[model samples]
Target: MVPSPVEMFRDLPKKVCPECGEYIEEQAESYMMECDRCLANKEE
Candidate 1:
């Protein structure tokens, strides 16, 4: 079975924070999944 390039890249580890728009650390263990700025500016 041959794996596609996109699939291979998708399987790689991510290092971007979803919440604070900060860069995730290589050794970090957890993600917030929501950007702080986004949340703060969210429509109420």
Candidate 2:
């Protein structure tokens, strides 16, 4: 059986970012997602 891209990366390690509540996949991604969320919130 082969796992799809999403399935393969589904359980890789993550954390619920306190600032954005996003399931972050990588350390870098967490920072990027946080900034994006902050920008989105500022716009709204």
Candidate 3:
């Protein structure tokens, strides 16, 4: 049987911030390697 859309999403790997080790939520079509907080701190 084929997997449902929800199941496919659940199987996707979780995106984590390399600098802060926090889970990164996908906000757009582009991929993000770090969380917003870490990115801001890095810019300082």
Cα error of candidate 3 at position 11, Å: 0.5
Ranking by lDDT: 3, 2, 1
lDDT of each residue in 1-44, candidate 3, tens digit only: 99999999989998988887999888769677889999898899
Arrange candidates, best TM-score first.
3, 1, 2
lDDT of 2 at 25: 50
Residue 28: error of model 3 in Å? 3.0
List candidate 3 segments past 4 Å from native: 1-6
Cα deviation of 26, candidate 3, in Å = 0.9
For model 2, the stretches where C-alpha displacement exceeds 4 angstroms are 15-44
TM-scores for candidates 1 onward, in order: 0.31, 0.28, 0.67
State the weakest 10-residue window (summed lDDT) of model 2.
27-36
Indicate whether candidate 1 or candidate 3 has the larger TM-score. 3
Give RMSD to native, each candidate: 6.8, 6.7, 1.9
Residue 39 local lDDT, model 3: 86
Worst 10 residues of 3 by lDDT: 25-34
lDDT of 3 at 19: 88
Q: With candidate 3 superimposed using the best TM-score fit, by how many Å does residue 37's alpha carbon deviate from the native?
A: 0.6
